[model samples]
Target chain A: MASNVSTKNTNNSNKNGSSSNSVISKLKNTFGLQQLIILIVLFLIYGLFAALSPAFRSGSTLTSIFDASYYVGFLALGVTFVIITAGIDLSIGTSMMCAAITGGVVYNQLHAPLWVALLVILAMATAVGCLNGFLVAKLKLPSFIATLGTMMITRGLSSILSNVQTETFPLRGTSDGWYKSIFRTSGDFPTGAIVLIGVAILCAIILNKTRTGRYIFAIGSNREATRLSGVNVVRSEAMAYIIAGFCAGLAGIAYAATYTTIMPGSGAGFEMDGIAAVVVGGTSLAGGVGSILGTLIGTFIMTVLKVGLPYLNLQPHYQIFITGFVVILAVYADIYRNRKKNQ
Target chain B: MKKKILFGTIFAALLLLVGCSGGNSSSSSKSSGGNSKNIEVVAKGFQHDFWKAVQSGAKQAAKEQGVTMNFVGPKDETAIAEQLEMLNNAVNKKPGAIALAALDTKAEIDAIKTAQEKGIPIIGFDSGVPNAPKGAVKATASTDNYKAGGIAAQHAYDAIKARIDSSATPPRIGIVSQEVNSLSISQRTGGFIDKMVQLLEANPKIGKGKVAVTGHDKFKNKVNASSAKAIIELRVPADVTDAAGKTEASALLKKNDTICVYGSNEFGAKAIINADDSVGGRIGNTEGKVVAVGFDSGKLQINAIKSDKFLGSVTQNPIKIGYEAVSLAVKAAKGQKVKNIDTGVKWYNKDNVDSKEIKPLLYQ
Candidate 1:
């Protein structure tokens, strides 16, 4: 077990740089000071909340933070690709709810097995992604406008399909309840955090390593230039939306596992939460620059504040109010970086 | 980099501390329970004045019991996942006891299970987590909305009896409900319909073949709308929105035979009041006015009652719901026997609306 831990650490250090001195030293070259500061800030805020409220430092409270972050973390990771391609997916939030409810309806109404319902959720979300890709890439619709339309359409569709009733997944102890263990176990371990971190790492690889990743950056940097250079800009940009849809599907699964009751007309504000995390993670709205690692840190920051504020007996609105300032500060950092580079 | 980091850290710390200090003072003032034995309350969002009344009541109970309380809810009712997170955090606090108004019970199963296992007794309030695990929920504090609905019907029946009897043409009774999906809303709608129908049947002039119930396919019956001596029609909108509710209410108001109308909650009552404007202000009880009876109180409904525009409204006493929840929670935490507490309802009109007894119960 110790060897396993050491190997994972070795793998992580190899990915970041070479020999592991300090994690900050390893990451500073690739990500620079922005993410390091944000990382420190996330811990600092957490420490402050713990100092103020004795309950905030409990193990269960950490689990609550992980529970809250799962869906949004998956969402932020997925939308990172699209944001890098200079596009936005307004439908991911509603689309995730719509797809998950359809999955639940399949399980209950169709009497399908739980696994089949889970697959249907993934397939339905990907299909929404395909539609998004087709509209923006083939039909040349504005990504924002196209996704906005799908957002409304999917929002209505979920209600129509579920008959406006709430759909619930199996409880953690039921016959088909093992799916919940994918996120959390009966022993109170939060396995979802591990799954989320793994997905984030994989998303980072896809965004930074592969051809689709490079093409996405190119298109965001200069769409006309990328197109003129014989890269299939439409297909590459569309792939980003498709990736987002796939992530939304994963997010839907995480949502179902973590919070079993799925309601229609929900998942609307979720996209904004996801988008805010991405923006807060040092991703420019103008696109072409973002890291999954930064996005991960951003997700933690958001979830920590959300879970921590309540420990101090603060209302949820304070989280939103403070997060607004945090996002503004992060965006200013991006603007400052761009200004410095131009000068 | 050091200066920027220091500045950012200070900025975030200052904001967080400001929030902490400011929020703690307000919450402490709300309860004044220095004992630090926390009772966490997770409620349905404050969609209307209803929840504010509930909060005030919770504060009342907390102050009396000498237990600090932390109250939180999602931004809106549809945010079920967010509510679950709140419930989970409530459990995580390991409060002395928990008072929960679950938005979706099935979604709350896991968190409730955790609370149960941890030996933290949970008191359900305001449509408490129905069908929760066998022993997870200790007791519930809520108005029996169906009973509350019946209370409205009894009052409405009294005011409209003469109107229905004197009408030469078969009089029509209308019901404007917000939606039919939720247990609380639907029960209120069903309760009023069933009770009013029962009351109308017992009357010598309007028995058996007189009442025809119709609308939304849920309440359709063999009695024809045109042929029956009187009609009991239910109007549930396509969605829960003010405009849709107003439209449904207006459709009933425009009909010439309609002599009385009922709205099940604050939203429904407000819709009826708003719809009355488009139809030349017909709702009242003085003479030829269409008698209107409503459930729950709001500013508009209170004003309407003051002017005799509405005959009366049934109020659920949300503050009592909040108060009882914390009281029950404290009892359960003390390992004392606890059972379901019905934080009953009241009917108020111009006669009693401003009276000391009824004034505290009415919201807005």
Candidate 2:
């Protein structure tokens, strides 16, 4: 509202005040209005939970909140790119588990080092992402159908590759336990939060300050206009999927670190959680408008609610019920914002 | 351009067929070739490690009996319709005998009735079909969940008795259950409460009405939490996600008066262990700590026992359940008198966790 008002004033008044208004608009553009709103909602929810349950205010609960966020955060980050391009990737859930379990296989059966196994997990998911890209972008299949097929494929593939067994990761104090420390040290430091934030910053740069980023936005807003403007829409669109795939890979690692047991048939409903976080963060499912900042705050909001609800001794069902309301309200807010922008 | 589109459609259709066929063939490949009798075994779909261990035992039994065994289940445990479809398909296959672990027996009445009409011997394993058509389930190979829960309580009571007796205020014993909807889980949870209440009542300091049973409505007694000599709190997460489970477990661990905590199953056990990581050194039999007793065995639970964070755990013999179900099915197929099998449970701590007797039962 402030930016809109200042712009009108600048057009009506003299040139002297235009410079300051322009700087203010630029500052507002960097953080944006919707993101700031969601950020406030995140804090408000935290304060409410804290007020209701003293245990929710403890440091350990904060760690628990972070523990829940790592994988979902990475997942929301990756899918943000795909959602921005107006395409959905349903396979990220199963594909993430498929890649993680395969990485466990590589570590256990092949005796690969931990770092090598992590790389294999990332590569495996990216490969699936590439396949999703090929089907949706090149073959002209709808993104939904393409990802749905891959979702079932990866679910079956994870079971087959691991022989329907639960793959075990290293425990704390083992030689390769250092990998678990990527998410948290044994002393209870949540290093994974730092890693999640750093990655978010990098993704923000790629989406905002890069050529592929502009193409993704342009393709989402007007595909025909982008093609007419001689942009390589196919390659740019494919990069979004690749990024999503890579993020799912990162999520796979985070999941293994936090839970330490990656079972077959895991990751079935996980895509919904990531997609929910993205939409709640003010990213329009209709596409062409989103921010990594919104997604980061969105992930925390979901996690804090999940982790904090237990403090009130509320059952998991109630938490799910409340989260359903939250998602609907966030989407409604998005619609309301869009309507106002148009008017 | 039209011809190319036709070619593309055919190519994609072929690929889809190939993909489906590839998945189908692998699952079907488990049964043996040749003239051997085939036995179809359907177990619970969720919890891969437990089911896989059972399958391993079934495979060994199939080899010993010279019969081909095919095991299958629905993707989720609560998928009643999907489980019914699988049961129907198993009956339709006309195998010599069928072994079923029904998630809901009434929902599977039609398929169970079909198997009985066809004179196929039906054996139950795990939480076998209870209250099925008169004699539809000829025998069940399962660990008595009530007895199993009693075993977990007996062991846990021994370690926490002194603390309960000595505390000025009523000491708290916490039970973390994954959920109370399932029969086996409810029985185990109920049995634990009954057994613990018995033990506390037996003590002179805490008589019958002095002990409070609180939490979910299914298990709550009339005794109030604050006025009681001892509190037995039962917590069940609304769902089965690890995060929810962890939160439930952590809540129990966080209470100051909590002297002992017990997790009902592998999921509960693993949740307690994960919750312990965030809380740090709080789950042990020491001063200002909690003693955690777990049911079932997973690597994390096993590690907890070895490290002395847990008092020990009660392990259900999944392998025996699998082996016995297949063995009984073979006998019944040959028209021999077959009775229900009771695959029992055992209590193992750090000392015997890796013992030869117990090691095979722990699937990681």
Candidate 3:
């Protein structure tokens, strides 16, 4: 009886050990633990900045970066999903501006109830995204050119809608409403950082654990093969653009929250930051691979550098020079890695 | 399967929660303050740091005066179209009063006219509505821009006169005016020209009232002809096409020596001082190089003045103008009549830039 009981216990222990090992192996295989190295590098860079500038570590300073980061970070995340499919989205930034401005007009100017305005913004953003997807996937236009066209059109549309200045949310004499609450919560850096983290997790789940996510990567890696496998290439690419657009709307709302009014050209030149973050985050511009985590960390690094350098008394324009250097270094490293992988 | 379900459930739940909460929060923000007795005061816009400073000052005044200030405008730089639309929308809302910096002097008159008809008092600031109908505005509070321009010209003469007195030959002077049509920039140029003319009349030996015609000497003589020569050889920034000479100011300095560079506006001033050719080198018999004077206080201009790169600049009480504009609106809303107020401008050299009164004008 004693020997039988010992045998049962030993069998249970062995089963548990193998299950844990399989889980570890699965995590390693699926998520790419190797990329955490970049995260560590980002952390070290942040640490260096925090140590160098007294203001860099201050709550207000950190918060300022976080505040700026939320808009940029959200845009980067949306672009990440698009990039993973080996596509690009240049219109996300302007589309967000258009969405915010349109929403502002509805909610603030026209006095439409706040939720109605938000839905209008969401619908507008999604429609623009759909238009981008339709041109790229359905109409067979090059993703780059398609989005570039969208960027111009959306920018022109935003200007035409607002006539030129930022449309203030909640209007004057009205308190901030639902639009402001979701996107413009008060409290400094961590609030923005926390919001970004929450959104990042949602994107990670959508990208990594979903069927659409798998198809995005598969299509990016080998479009012909993905088609042969009976996955709809057009749908996958279109979906990517739609996702990017939805995220842009989210980013726009975030921007309106943090800043009092959206400036004309508010989202202008922001696509560069998204592209930079995606490229730096280890997404090959050529297609088939990316890291949401890497992009998140990349955003942090960029935002910190942007906010920290200026606080350290370095001129604002000088930060652009450093960012260019970082992008070059990232691309060089990526090329080196590709060569190693090929070998 | 359970994990996937949980994820799906959470995602759906989150969306619903955000959607529901978003609806509730926006309504709450809209209703955060139920006091309808408050007068709505809309600022023209906050595109630049100058606007931000003005907004802050106006808000402070609003709080002290127990009025609500609604500061909103187009988010773009120099977007008059958006400003015009906002004015129309503000008037539609029937705000107690609206304070505006007319985006265009003439384009916004219709909206101002309508708002006046509605009995919503309008107070103009910074760039006042010059063409508003007689009864359209309650009062205008701004720097006497014409006077301010005249001051800039007077200072230019003072600085140049001292240098000319010490020189063997007459010193050539250059003017950088922003827009020929912009009353402010043109007035400053006019004031400077008027002052130079007066000085020249007073001392003809100094070569006053003389126009230096470069390029075609024949064109110089035909003042009324199509290609008439300039009386004063001015090197306006290329961006200022209408300013007698539209070539970049640097080219103007290169073409003529004995040039005393005066920037008629902020952009003109910045371009003149920052130009590579603006290095200190003697102009003709003048022992020192071109003395650069500009209008407006920007960080670059302030620092330049501090370092003696510029002789001095005219500092307008931009914040005072914004604050008074809002205050006047509130008073006018309450049936109190407010007259045109002069916020005023002052000249700041390196020595005075650090002074308490001047420091507030220098954002940096």
Candidate 4:
């Protein structure tokens, strides 16, 4: 499986070298042309919105964009790994909300310290992810079905735990509200943006520089061949889901910080945004190809469109339609680029 | 193949267990006695404290009236199809009467017709189906949402009239409506916009200058906009989420000329408060403070009003709406003439929020 992927990469690079001898084309080939094109599209959307609405260019609007992207960014980053492993984690959205709601219950109902509740959020989400991994890897359940069941379960659990009440975290001025500053400061600075970038850098390292990452790519490329090579394919596959779960945990914390009120059943559609971001970032749903940096860029593109649509005198509904088109375009670009390489 | 079969069996058993547990938990009450009349009350949803209050009110009425009240609702307001299914199930039971808070007025018309065909009476609450077929709906119990909105507009106008008269440019008042799809919300937003415009035009000082009502195509089409001394800007979020509400509110609150803002529901009110907290915008009639008014009461909104974070709010009597709905249903069940009941609304502020008259109506 490893040799197969390496050979394909070489073939694509050779195709690029033969197709275009220009220095610019070589630069594009070196950097990955698909990622470059996506980056250009992201900037074009941002620049267009800025040009259309003066308010879109302000510092505060930039802060709002960053605030909106943190939770989705973490989800996208984690799910990118699962997608690359030829798997899906539909539970991340609800699991993130449920984790946050559990943290709220611990803080408000059990009188736990704020720090303890934060740890509880991370632990709970990771635990859910481990469950997802166990179902998919150990039991041989499909990732889609396992995560879908987990999604409904977590969503119901959240509603039951919170008792259908909106769980509000402490506001910034309150004594226990200092934790909010982890994502955003009282002065409205986008501290979460820095945290997201740092997390992305770490994920990029894991995906590029580690044995587990290589094994994951190998398993996705050819699971049977990877097992034949005497690799623990089950453990490697499970690790991908565990990584997604950890990211979901972090996403829970980010969501709690950005929108202090956590309502049960409200996070149902959020996972789609994360999945869309991963796909738009050039991560193939078929697996074995993705990057955390590309996911980050994709997250910004989505956030920009969400925050900018209202400023251009367009209603929020238009954002969904335009985003749908952009996702289709990004995936089409991916398929088109791959077809070119094959030819 | 053996492992797959084992997994499938376990999964099936787990699903069965979950299904049984869900059925047991959701069935709140069994039929009390053979002689007791059964009345089913289908609410919008149990997503908020408001619906819980409504359920309690219905239960209280049931206990007093010596009837069996089975209260059920969908998980959230967006589940209209689920609600319709529940309504159909209620009809199948042949209840003496059904009290409904219809999520979609049009969607319920057929169900109402079916209930009528089955000789079951339907009583509407919270939101009434204005266009229901004749005799399909016996009566309705609800607050006059339009008047409630006018109350909000009245208080807001009183606070900002001086500023409106004195500002060199047109002063803006923003309304953050949760959605336009719901009859209650649309009426509330429209009520406020129309009343605010009416007050502006009625005042000699403001009427001398033009009055413009803009933003939100639904409300914009209803009012005339000209070069005016006052502008009422209405904003409705694409969806009913805290993030969307906050975004819409923040956009309106950020305007330099915005002197007042009104959130038309609990979510909308919280959104306004959240935006104010983010931007450090004060909420009161004092100089430089943007007066904030809200509709509906929640713990957050109540605290905000108490802390002077809001000018005041217009609150509906949800408990009364529930009680009246069941009462009307029972009356219709008895073959008596039942008329639409106004559950009423009141404007509460920091000074009167704890008053006896206002305290009972305030839900968590």
The C-alpha TM-scores of every prediction are: 0.83, 0.50, 0.52, 0.50
**TM-score pick, better of 1 and 4:** 1
How many backbone clashes does every candidate have?
Answer: 0, 0, 12, 1
Q: Rank the candidates by lDDT, best first.
A: 1, 2, 4, 3
Query: What's the C-alpha lDDT at position A75 in model 2?
Result: 93
User: lDDT by residue for model 4 over A49-140, one digit each (tens)?
Assistant: 56544435667567767877899999999998888888999999999999999999999899999999999999988998899989998898
Off by over 4 Å in 3: A1-34, A170-174, A177-189, B1-364
Q: Kindly list the per-residue Cα lDDT of model 2 for residues B1-364, writing each as its tens digit.
A: 3323433443344334323433443333334223127787888773577887798889899999988777766666755544654565456456678889987675466568767887878999998888888888889899988988988889988888888878888889999898898788888888898999999899998987889999899999999888899999998887789999889888988888889889999898998999989887689856667888999887899889999899999989988999999998888777788998879998999999889989878877
| Candidate 4 Cα errors over 4 Å, as ranges | A1-31, A341-343, B1-364
Task: Report DockQ per prediction, comma-separated.
Answer: 0.35, 0.01, 0.03, 0.01
- Candidate 3 residue-wise lDDT, B1-364, digit = tens: 3323433443344334323433432422232132232344444565567777677778877778876566655554455544554465455445577787776545455456667777888888776777777888788888776677667767767766665556565456676666566677667666666565556446555443344433223213323322322235544443444332324666656644444777777777767655633544322223465677778877777777877778888878867877888888888877787999988888998888889887777554
Local distance difference test, per candidate? 0.83, 0.80, 0.66, 0.78
- What is the per-residue lDDT of model 1 for residues A1-343, given as tens digits with 9 covering 90 to 100? 2221232233335434445477534334434556677788788788877776666778999988898899999889989888877789999999999999999999988999999999999999999999999999789899999999999999999999999888889988899999999988988899999999999878877766677877887777668877998999889989999989999999999999998988876788899989989988877677666778888999998898888877767687776787777777777777765564344
* Alpha-carbon deviation at A120 in model 2, angstroms: 0.8
Model 3 interface RMSD, one decimal: 18.6
Cα lDDT of candidate 4 equals 0.78
What TM-score applies to chain A of candidate 1? 0.90
Minimum summed lDDT over a 10-residue window in model 4 chain A is located at A1-10
Model 4 pairs in collision: B210-B228
